[model samples]
Target chain A: MNLLTDLIFDYTLRNIALGAAVLGIVSGMLGSFAVLRRQGLLGDTLAHAALPGICIAYLLTGSKSPLVLFLGAAISGWVATLVLLRIVRETRIKEDSALGVVLSVFFGVGIMLLTFILKHNDANQAGLDKFLFGQAATVTAEDVNTMTILGVFALLVVAVLYKEFKIMTFDPNFAASLGFNDRWLGVILTSLIVVAVVIGLRTVGVVLMSAMLVGPAVAARQWTNRLEAMVLLAGFFGALSGVAGALISVSEANLPTGPMVILSLTVIVIISLLFAPQRGILWDIKRFSKA
Target chain B: MEIVITGILISVACALLGTFLILRKMAMMSDAISHAILPGLVAGYFFAKGPDLFAGFLGALVAALVTVTLVEALKNTQRVGGESAIGIVFPAMFALGTFLVARFFENVHLDTDAVLFGNIEFVAFDRLFIGDVDFGPQSYYVAGALCLINLLFITVFYKELKLATFDAGLAATLGFSPFFIHYALMALVSVTSVGAFTSVGAVLVVALMIVPAAAAYLLTDKLPMMIGLAAGIGALSAVLGYGLALAIDSSVAGAIVSVAGAFFFAAMLFSPSHGLIAKARRIERQRVQIGLEALLVHLLNHEGEEGEAHESEMLHLSSELRWLPQFAQQIVGVAANRGLVMQLHGHLILTDNGRRQGQQLMVH
Candidate 1:
């Protein structure tokens, strides 16, 4: 009981909890677009792609300003998206193939760059390597502040573009006929997705970021048909997983926060996918049996 | 020249397997199979010690078969869609594989990175010798043999494969076993994927399998033409992507995939029958036709109601329709030329013959 009180009172633990809460809210709101677009993989790809950008930013600037690294990450992420789009548009390749291709290639390049950077750079580069797997314990007050500002910005953008985003997603052709500038809408939505991914990458790492985007939204989708309700539910689920993961990781010394968060989200998704009332697998089976 | 020859051979193999993958709509299964085979690869690494390509290939093959069989069983028993089964099985299996790698083989050289993105640079290091002369690269032979085997198997059972793919029910009625064909196709996919694992890795192999076939699909509907086109596209992409990668100092697989995407985009926009551009043009033409028809109907309706032709109503009708003034004018001109309307003192009146023609047009 004494150990539990001491652990909870620790500043580091409190900071991690706060950071996870902000990340949870942001990912939950943005993941809806990702799930709707069937871009559950984009989060993973963009997160991995951020490695080189962060490394390059460090190399060029010689300072680890979260703002500069984030800018670099956004640029690389957008480039990856462009490459993915170009591949799907130009080739006879399927969307998933293009996604896999872009993801692996960009990630491979990022890994190579990271390896090179680590070998050449000083020991200060140690923490940077942790970004690949994530070390939520290392998150600072500065990170929390940055996350809060970005989260608010992302939520505001989503709020402003909610109607247009919803219409374009459900029926793009109809949206286009209404002169809704679908291209701009796509760009805005993608930018928001990229930002959400980059922010989550700091907490969850590249490998698990995609799961964060997919898991909560997928689970939330089973519970609601209305877009607003789905987004809210997804955010709530994301927060729950984030808090639970943080608590578990903090309690256990060797357990990694990112994987724990991912596992929690995965459990939520599996439950929703299998057991939720309306669109769950169990529901489908029940209906089918009756027929 | 040697590289181009090797690329062409690989492309041909990819094309053959790609067509069946696309036709079966199991294109994304290649991606799932690649990831799910990690445990097999780790196990292979443990036994083989070094980078035993064949061991990895066999392991991956076994994993692929397991994935396919399980997915098929789930689909049959649970009455689930292919995508749902794939979604559930692959991720769970992949997570399991990841757990194994992380827990037991953390320090081992075998990692997800190595399996997912293959080292093409190292592929040339292994050369299979035919007596004294080196037979190009080892992967070429391995992938080539699998491709040939796949092609032969597909060709021998072409009729059955086609029947199963197009209409499994019809094949069943005609005394053909779709189950056998399905298994054979999955086996071929497994072999091709495992064999290509060394050169392109798991992800790029999927790109090779799906992209070329998808591009070919956009260009043609006939199975034979699609197969041929897909092979050509795959070969072209492999060679071109290699050259482009060399030129840019980038990853070869990435370059190839980007190039394939470019091809697909071109087909989507410009293909004569099914391209988005063509579809858009068709929509535009239909809209024009509808507008003209609506204007003609309005004029005919007015003419039927009036004993005398009225110029005021004709002018008023043009303004009321609002959107397509030019199309409306064209309709009026066409009607007038056909002697459907007579012009008197700026008032247009429909003749008895014109009224009869209009009524006939409405009926049919």
Candidate 2:
């Protein structure tokens, strides 16, 4: 008990937990759009694409400011997204293929660059390699503040454009006919997603970031049909998983916080996907039996 | 140039797999299998105690089969769709694999990066020799053999596969078991996925397996044509993308995928029967016809409400509804030339035959 109390008070532990909490909220909010748009894989692709941006930022600035790195990451992410869209538009490739292609190419380049940097540049390139698998323990107060501001900005954008987003996603042609500027709306939503992914990269890394984005929203979707409720519940689940995973990792020195957090979100999604009311597996089974 | 050759070989293999996956509506299963095989890979490494590629392949095959069997069982027993079952099982398995890796293999350089991203640059390092002449790249042989085998299998059993894909119930009634074919296809997908994992990685493999097939689907309705087109597109994209990537110093897989996307979009917008442009034109034509019909109906309703004989309007009409203003005007001009409607003091009047035709139009 004393050990647990002592661990909670540790600065690193607090920083990790707070940073994770902020990321969870951000991922949860943006993940709702991802799930609704049926672009759940987008987050994963964008996260992988962020790696090149971090490396570039480090190379250019020689400073490890989270803000600069994140901005660079966001730009790269948007570029990846644009490439994906271009591929889908200009070629005979399917959307999933485009996503996979963009994700791998960017990530592969990032890996190569990172290796080069490690060999040639400063050996103490602090916190950059951690972006691959993520090191939540290294998150600082500055990260928390940045994440909080971004999270608030993302949430405000979602709130202001909720109806437009709903119309555009559900019936894009009709929204276009109604002169809603659906193209612009899509751009805005995608940008927000890119930003959210960039911010969360510090906490979750490229590999498991998609899980954070998809898992909570998937879980929340099982419990409700209303978009608002699902988004709220998703946010709650995200925050809960983040905090719980952080606590677990802090309590146990061997466990990595990113994967633990991802696992927690995965568990929640599995539970909801299997046993939740209405859209759950059990519910589907019951309906099938009745039919 | 080496990357280009490797890309082409990989694309052909993926194109072959993509055909079946697209036909079966199991495109996303490739993605799930790619991720689910992680635990098997880790276990294989442990047993071999090193980077044993063959062991990894065997382990991945086992993992994929288990995944397919479990997903199938869940679907049968619980009535869950393929996607949902996939959603539940693969992630859990993946998490377990990740956990195990972190716990045991953290110090051994065994990580998700190697599994998910793969190291294509090292493909040349692993050489497969054919009796003194070294086969340029080892993976080329493996992937090439698999592709050839897949092509042969598909061709030999084309009739059975086609019948099953299009109408499973009919195939079952005809004494061909779709269940066997389904499992066979799944097994093939699993094997190919494992083989391809080393070259293209997990994520890009999914693209290779689905995009080309989907693009082919947009261009044709016939299965044979679709398969051929898919292979062609896949190969073309691979070459183009690899070249582009080399020139730009970017990712080969990304360029290839983008090229595939470009093809699909073009097909979606330009295809004759179902393309966006054709559909839009059809809608426009339909709206014009509907508007004309509504206008005629409205004029007819007004005539009936007035309780008038409507002799003048009736006389000017032909089998076409001439009471509607636009139709009336058009018909009058045509009738005058044909000597059916005669004009008196700017008022249109019909001859005996014209009046008969007008009455016929109303009755019909």
Looking at candidate 1, what is the lDDT of residue A28?
A: 83
Model 2 lDDT per residue over B174-200, tens place: 999999988888888888778877876
Provide the DockQ value for model 1: 0.15
C-alpha local distance difference test of each model: 0.71, 0.74
Scoring only the A-chain of each prediction against the true A-chain gives TM-scores of: 0.92, 0.93
What tens digits encode model 1's per-residue C-alpha lDDT throughout B32-84?
A: 67666766766666678755776866777787889888777655644334544
Report how far residue A122 has shifted in candidate 2, in Å: 7.4
Poorly placed runs, candidate 1 (over 4 Å): A1-196, A200-210, A216-291, B1-6, B69-92, B95-99, B129-133, B172-183, B287-317, B320-323, B326-364
- For candidate 1, report its TM-score: 0.69
Residue runs of model 2 more than 4 Å from their true location after superposition? A2-8, A33-39, A45-64, A76-129, A162-190, A222-229, A250-254, A273-291, B1-7, B22-26, B68-91, B128-140, B163-183, B211-364
CAPRI tier for the interface of model 2: incorrect
TM-score of each: 0.69, 0.71
lDDT per residue for candidate 2 within A1-291, as digits (tens), equals 754665468788878887888788878877887777777777777887887888898889887887888887888898888877866675445566566556655765675566557666766785677766678888888887887888889889999999998888778899999999976898788888888887778887766677777778778888898888988998989998898888877675577788788788877876887888767788776888999
Per-residue lDDT over A179-245 for candidate 1, one digit per residue giving the tens place of the 0 to 100 score: 9998788878877888887777778766556667766777788888899999999899988888777
